[model samples]
Target: MNTQPDAPRHVVATSADADTVLRRLAREGWTARSGFALPDPAWDVAAHRIVLHGRIADDDTETVALAVLAAARGAGVVAVCDPESAAGRALIDDLSRIGAVHRGTDGADPVASLIPEQRALLDRLAAGDTIAAAAAAEFLSLRTANRRIAEARALFGVRTTREAVLAYLRQRQPE
Candidate 1:
């Protein structure tokens, strides 16, 4: 986690966009590496002029990358998206709602791997009769539920003002 107070915040979501950005950085003599996941990879994120990560959720890509790249600008972040993915859409909406600059081809590309762990969680959340109860059941902690559900909302591109899966849970709950 590059939690520096000053870092460039940028996002590269799709493999293509990432390729463009990374190649540009490489052309500029910015050291770059790409893989499915890192195994205790060690690099001073602050020291690197550019960083690239792939196969991450659209939201995570944007939010985390922004946190890394835009740390100097009050936690700046950027996310690239394929445009066709629901998760990508959600990422765009979430970032846009929060005034984050989202860049990429917005043509919808089915970027659906963002919440592989969330289906069961959403199912559990829907089992309760109230928002708070659903939160309790799904997350077992209000703070955790709040955070996770909000992330889910952003990952799924659900159009609710609360930006939480709890909104779905609450709706499913019988009056």
Candidate 2:
């Protein structure tokens, strides 16, 4: 396992998402490879990228992919799937929340910005509960809750939890 704290991260939650991103990247003249395992022998992540596709709920695929990620270090890993599927959504959300810090990119994608638990708390807040109340409902300590709220605020580029909530809502609003 590479065990490096900073690594590039990428994910496409559906085959369609994969197609769209890949097409765009290709248009930008980037090279990519799609597969179930890491590229053999040697691969330059900065120059070449890999996309992993399949149901995460399927037999041990996620586990293996995680192992591969650990070994590959700087390589970009894209999880491609059908986001409409429950498993796909879960995978995307999970990856988004955890992978954001590792992406090494300038700005975070709002959709993948929060972990499910944080999002749940935000949902409660959006429904009009006080921050303390929402934190209590989620069984988080006041300190931990505040930490998560702060993290969410930083992720969304806002100063207050309410602003974060509004930003989240705006992001989710349909165009």
Candidate 3:
């Protein structure tokens, strides 16, 4: 229910890494995930950074990194390699072309920050109300309402308000 989305995710490709990292991260107060397909459920609010294993100075590694990035759509990724190594530097350069934000624990609880107003707006949006109507229901002006929805759009990394609402529902909803 977080009105503002979390930073890039901290994810692993396997539960083994997930397990170990989870334990270590738990000590440091970081939430983490592992072993999931990069399709369907969006991960923007969950994962903050990606920790890649092995030497990431090759085409294969970049391909893997792109997959993870696609899942969360974050600023940048990190690899468990020698940052000073030639390959590592090259990988960094390649990824920097996209963007890189250090996924931090400040984003531990993606749902913890949902404000009532934002949730109400999303509820209206999910209920199929127009942005104008939804805003009016909340006694807000159209511009203000659009701004809030825009936040949801950016936070969920979707192009449309409907997609953002869907992302909100998927995460906030119970299976």
Number of clashing residue pairs, candidate 1? 15
- lDDT tens digits, residue span 1-110, model 2: 53433333344445665566556555655555555455555653433444343324434446445634532544444454444466555544445433442211233466
- Count of backbone clashes, every candidate in sequence: 15, 2, 12
Cα displacement (Å) at residue 144, model 1: 1.4
Which has the better lDDT: candidate 1, or candidate 2?
Answer: 2
Which is the winner by TM-score between candidate 1 and candidate 3?
Answer: 3
Number of residue pairs clashing in candidate 2, backbone atoms closer than 3 angstroms, sequence gap of 3 or more or interchain: 2
Off by over 4 Å in 3: 1-110, 173-175
Positional deviation of 55 in candidate 2, in angstroms?
Answer: 8.2
Query: Best TM-score goes to which candidate?
Result: 2
What local lDDT score does residue 133 receive in model 1, on the 0 to 100 scale? Answer: 69
RMSD to true structure for each model, in Å: 10.8, 6.6, 14.4
What overall lDDT goes with each candidate model? 0.44, 0.56, 0.50
